[model samples]
Target: MATRSAPPSDNLLARIALRFTAFTERWLPDAFGFVLVGTVIVLLLGLATGQSPTALIDGWGKGVWSLVTFTLQMAMIIIGGYALATARPVARVIAWLATIPRTPRAAITFTAAASMITSYLNWAFSLIFAAILAKEIARLVRGVDYRALGAMAFLGLGTVWAQGLSGSAALQVASAESSPKAVQEVIKAGRGTGLIPLTETIFLWQGIVATLIVFVVAVVTAALIAPSGERAKTAADLGIELKPLISPLEAEPKGRPGDWLERSPVFSVLIFAIGAWYLVRHFVNATGSPLNALDLNTINLILLLLALILHWRPHRLVTAVREGAPAAAGVLLQFPLYGGIFGMIAFTGLSATIAGWLVDISNPVLYPALIAIYSCVLGVFVPSGGSKWVIEAPYVLDAANQLQVHQGWMVVVYDLGEASANLLQPFWMLPTLAVLGLKARDIMGYTFAMFLVCFPTVLIVVTLFARTLSFP
Candidate 1:
């Protein structure tokens, strides 16, 4: 007969991570204030690095508006994704999945698995779907822990999104149309480096393996730290009650011809038909080709078209937008402030200085790890992957060229690092926490558990796999 060993403790690393999470909760302000702090930090760095006050201030002013087009794209992605999640069919699916768990351990584990898979489809959908699903499961399964389940939902974004179809940095670098002008220009400057195809990044074996590892680790961690019995909080205990945000039934307007048009499915179906045609033609044209057109634009267009088709009625789409708009408010409010920080970093040459320091320390073998670590730190201050890539891609790509590193692996490393930092950074949690009616502190503990469990996995996988791809 064998005796089972004692269950593992949270470990020193996990304890430290939890302590850091607690410290930040007490001291760190909301996402808006976080960006404001970032702006100040960037400004001070600019001044300290010998930039004139006039130039620094002017850079911030111009930078704040530099991302107008990109901002619109991001906004559409969020709202469109939310609209897709709000569809009755999607809600029904989530509700069905919520009933599949029989125990608290099974509930948390299943939530983590489902959330990670959904995140790999689209981060926005993952956020809304997982939050609602967790709540639904908690309501259905007595003694389920809302805090653990909520953290699992949020953990998906921090874990698998970097390897996902809608991942911001990966999609941006994979196609010219999806990349910002700044990123494209930098790619142009890099020697023999042009658009990186997703086949080499997201579709690669390394990416697939790393993502699988992350999902497994996340689920296991959720199960390991989950509370039991009286410690568990049910849906009611957590005060999470979700109502239908978008109603399928539209109220008809009296005596107005346009009202009929607005409420009819015919026009919306026609519009979605056009979008469907574009998507089909896009893939058809690239059949059997190495070059493809799947990017952020494609992802957003598909999301929008799907939402329109699902909603059927034009007025329902409007209602869905109204429902989803609040979740995206934080993105709109904080993105421009980050745009300014981007300006300060890019225009003031701070990014170059940082990049140069890394290049000086990096050999071929060390480059991937160094890039990953650097991107993790950068992700904390600028959580927008597209925005962060716009600033970092130029120097990062240039260094990769010099070191003979594969651009695909370089992009992958950067993406993994950014996603890793999401464990510590709570910017993306604003919408998620709002929907779940939980505080950041409630979820951060489990998120940090995942971070401790998965960060080294990312570091090791990317570092080793990048070498193989680059050398081979």
Candidate 2:
């Protein structure tokens, strides 16, 4: 029988379909797939290792529930805060930031410094604020490359050091070494407590000094490596300044007479509420049940509700929530997969196997050096310091116990691993890429160079500091 060939239109349609699928695959975050795959791997591992399927399923169910709830809470905060901040006229924010004096260099420096410091606030907040500030600084400079500056700002603000110093995951690990209820104890100890080995611990001064020295080196290196002349043109070309902030009044200047609450009302009431919640939760430890739930999620929910009340627009609130959903979808989806991978590690004894190997090689004297290197390597896969710490902290604590390593030394190693790989992670490049409207490939070209130079410098400093301070 003579074969009937496919129609030209059908072939064209098939090609177009293929092209569309490829495009979606290229850009859209594949976190969902990653999670699903990880879950399967975990399941397979459970079966292979003769672990009870029922237990695995139960554990996974709880982990997934926690992951989803945590992801949603984090997403809401990021989206809500971003929407509120962007709702205001960008020109006003720029004008405000400009009045800070030496608007160009100072803004860049402050933004960089603030990014580093406020990372303790929350990574999402730091990223958003730094991005906004970098955009404003770019506008003031007229011809400076804001995208590059944005990358630098992110590096300084959101880097591993900030993550390490922040009393979050790393602190929990360090405290766990001495106390089982480490997180609560560390919280009780307050920010003034010696959580970071660099800032605390008697023998680990070298590691701390090394971290500082390396940070300085990284900063100087970034400054030296920034593009010069025309190569350093404004981020305007990259579409950063395209979305000019329009005032709500300007959008409807001749509308019905503005209400009393609309005219000179405090828009920052939400910010204040969030602050009050933090203070009550962290310091006062208020007895009220409501105050207890005022974690990252509750705080964000409070802000969103406040924004809605102040704006008095149900439609706008819905729209903001819809818009914000995508902002956190990647994390929401991808973290679960990581959780699944973690499940496999736990079920299959892979993590324990790795830990045993590490313990065997880990000498108390060399633990700091080994930890610094191990952390840097791990940085490739688990880019987020907070997230990485969650997975690795337990192992580190276990290793510390096995080798009789000090909690302070362990903390130093965790920080070293994290900091050395900050410039190298592809995920950390997102804000810069977003600001620049560039692909990862383009930015990686520059960032990889920075990473190559910075990593070795940091490693050496960490090693020297560990040796000098006698951390172990």
Compared with the true structure, all predictions reach lDDT values of 0.75, 0.51
TM-score of 2: 0.66
Cα misplacement distance, residue 29 of candidate 1 (Å): 2.4
What is candidate 2's lDDT per residue for 60-122, written digit by digit as tens?
A: 665544455655655666667556545444336644764563534344455555555545444
Error of 1 at 186 (Å): 8.1
Residue 381, candidate 1: C-alpha displacement in angstroms: 1.6
Q: State the displacement of the C-alpha of residue 10, model 1, in Å, after optimal TM-score superposition.
A: 8.9
Those runs of model 1 whose alpha carbons end farther than 4 Å from true positions after fitting are 1-25, 48-51, 168-195, 229-235, 244-259, 282-292, 439-441, 470-472
TM-score of each: 0.83, 0.66
Candidate No. with top lDDT: 1
Per model, how many backbone clashes are there?
Answer: 0, 5
